[model samples]
Target: MLVTALTKLLNIRIPIIQGGMQWVGLPQLAAAVSNSGGLGILTALTQPDPNALRLAIRETRKLTPKPFGVNITLLPTINPPDYEGYARAALEEGVMIFETAGNNPAHLVKSFKDHGCIVIHKCTNIRHAKSAARLGVDVLSIDGFECAGHGGEEDIGGLVLLAKAAQELDIPYIASGGIATGRGLAAALALGAAGANIGTRFLCTVESPIHQSIKDKIVASKEQDTVHIFRTLRNTARVYRNTVSEQVIALESLPGGARFDELRDLVSGQRGRRVFETGDPDYGIWSAGVALGLINDCPTCEELLRRMEREAEEAIKGMAELVQG
Candidate 1:
């Protein structure tokens, strides 16, 4: 039973958190993680609308009575889904935990805190973390350059970012990006994080909603198998090194950089969703972190969580013995 501020705050036995991945964070995976004593998150916008989100929340509740969160990512889409509607739906469904990412959550933070909800905002750098802290976000999930999806443009990895966060931040934060194993969990604690947020590793779990082939590819991939795309557009995203992602990189390398309109068809979220639905890896670009190299097998959520707990304890104990004092 590894206890920390995150565990106490979320009322979970373990400090690990399952990242709210789009097209992946569903009832099955979220409930699995929560049942394993870690915080699980359902992607709110993954549902078609607020009504659908309510149903998904209800479905997750049926799977596990344990606490779970809803992830509402705020991005600048041409025709965005109803963000407030999703939040309200989650609140109406009695979900008190939220994981917000992309854009400042100023518009919704007050309402969430006022309703006694704990908001965990994901940030790529210290500047964004501090800004979110000032906005009254309960906790921060600090992402590194090795993270999947949008990793921001700073390109700072978790090692230096987590250490810098420990020195400067006043609020409790969890380390995100490139963390898959128990040793990674222990390292996050050593760096002053309340816990760790895992995305890519969780995606490769037995219970993950993705296709088996996708999981297999992740298991076989190395740390360098991921490519950082959209850097020329300023909204950098780390994705699996697939044919489509490589094509996007090529287009971005064109003179004056590629515009969002040119890459829109290739990077469409629907296309990426198909990759998960089907077993075709080259169908579209999918988000994957450097932690893919650390994942060797697809175990059940329960098996993974228990193993991580044991390994983290062993790692901490072994490190204590190394001290000369």
Candidate 2:
């Protein structure tokens, strides 16, 4: 009943989006969220190859017939995978929704649009959001500095970021970063966002592929438990406060500072992936937002979305009463 542009656009029952988390956005989790009436997204790059991505898409389809999407983040890596190959695989599988992020997404936007796929580009600032809008993306997922991964160096929080994007962009945008609860969803709607793009909260869900220990850590965390690292490298990422993340911060804090190469081993994506399977938070640097502190329990995707929808309705009704009082 909390219908909005996002719900209409994505053809979902609610306007909640499970942010495409790397490694964690597996078929099981994505299918659960989609089956629960929210837009679940699979991280396309999680697959080892394009053929593997197609298999993952097929697996997700087997789990749920609801609308879901694939996230193809275009970030800088020393050995980047074939992004075009992944996109082509998804397109061939009849995927019509895509969530793109990192670096300039104009090329991917044009490609997805040409194939008639709805592209939702994630941006950390209004400038990027506007640029993506002009690039013909269908929607913008506006992430603020509170976001977990690659929050950019702007230091803007979701409040100002969402409102500014609403004021500036013609394309409807979702408010991301530090968004978790029903109150958060209601706030995003009040701030002129079509919905809330949630990452950390979804990581704590039962369907999330992360280790149970990691989910427990997120549940026990506080809002201030996260720290931003790699600002010196201009590839800032907000992660849970752990020994490894702290170590990265310390190295970056040195007088001369450490280069990305020096920190590469400790922050490698492979190590981080292993952490999800091995139940070791300090195994490597992983992406987690300040919203982890907001998570207190691990609910099934169906239960979580339903509760959020109820909470949003109550919040909206409360606001209406205040206005009519």
Candidate 3:
């Protein structure tokens, strides 16, 4: 199968781009996915400082010589005493691709562009995608409301959003949200997308940094299992309906403590860090997509990417044969 504009821009073989996840998109996970032919994104603020980010980048480089990038989410967060410091580290480390989420990345964009880097900004809605496109980002990762982490409160599905993007913007945009299989890939292409970006399905894989217990929960989940929380503040995020998430939702409704950090203690950095590092699920409540239902096994990244490509090719060929007949 041919690579999408993202893969071509990132110089990777697979069109799949590992969503930059905080607490999950570690250097190990980034290297695994990139070396497997997909673009792995290292969460910029994943570490405490640029030194740690640099260390993670170096460690990932030690593991694989493939292309990778750093994800800078311009949202409210603690770490990153100096965001530019992390960006500078990424640049100094020779990180060629940069993926950003939330707000205008103009300063970072100009800097990264000056350094010969291709930028991809994840957007939850068409307006954001358009803004990113205007910022001259190399790619637009259209994260519909179905994706994990912070998704827009917008009710538009990828089916509707992709077409809306195609109608408004002429830039290369990829479809995300509820994508798991080759069929989703094919559907994305048919909807005028160059490729598909998968998160929840990828999280269930062995190469992911999330705990196996969380993966099990995702495996057991269905398309309707996820719910949107924090919508009242426009900081809405799609979270797996866990006991903790339920509490978070309940509290948000009553206005006791609705900040993202309220559950921060329940799922503390120390606790979450250990869970992801040790594969202990009970220690934390991680993010997941509704597409979890489509994931079944924890295969290696190479195996998953290769199989997806092969299956996509076969499915398309089979459809071609039918049309020919």
> How much lDDT does each candidate structure score?
0.93, 0.90, 0.79
lDDT of 3 at 46: 73
Candidate 1: worst-modelled 10 consecutive residues by lDDT: 75-84
RMSD of each: 0.8, 1.0, 2.4
Residues 39-158 of candidate 1 have per-residue lDDT tens digits of: 999999889999999999999999999999999999977887899999999999999999999988998898999999999999999999999999999999999888888998888989
What does the lDDT read for residue 305 in candidate 2?
94
Candidate 1 lDDT score at position 22: 96
- Candidate 3 stretches with Cα past 4 Å from truth are 77-81, 255-283, 322-325
Candidate 2 residue-wise lDDT, 1-325, digit = tens: 9889999999999898899999988999999999999999999888899999999999999999999999999878777889999999999999999999998877778889999889998998998888888899988999988888888888999988888887788889998998889998999999999998899999999999999999998888898888888888888889878889999999999998899988989888899998899999889888888887679899999999999999999999999898752
* Model 1 score (lDDT): 0.93
Query: Number of the top candidate by lDDT?
Result: 1
Reference-based lDDT, residue 280, model 1 = 92
**How would you order the candidates by lDDT, starting with the best?**
1, 2, 3
RMSD of 1: 0.8
TM-score, model 3 to reference: 0.91
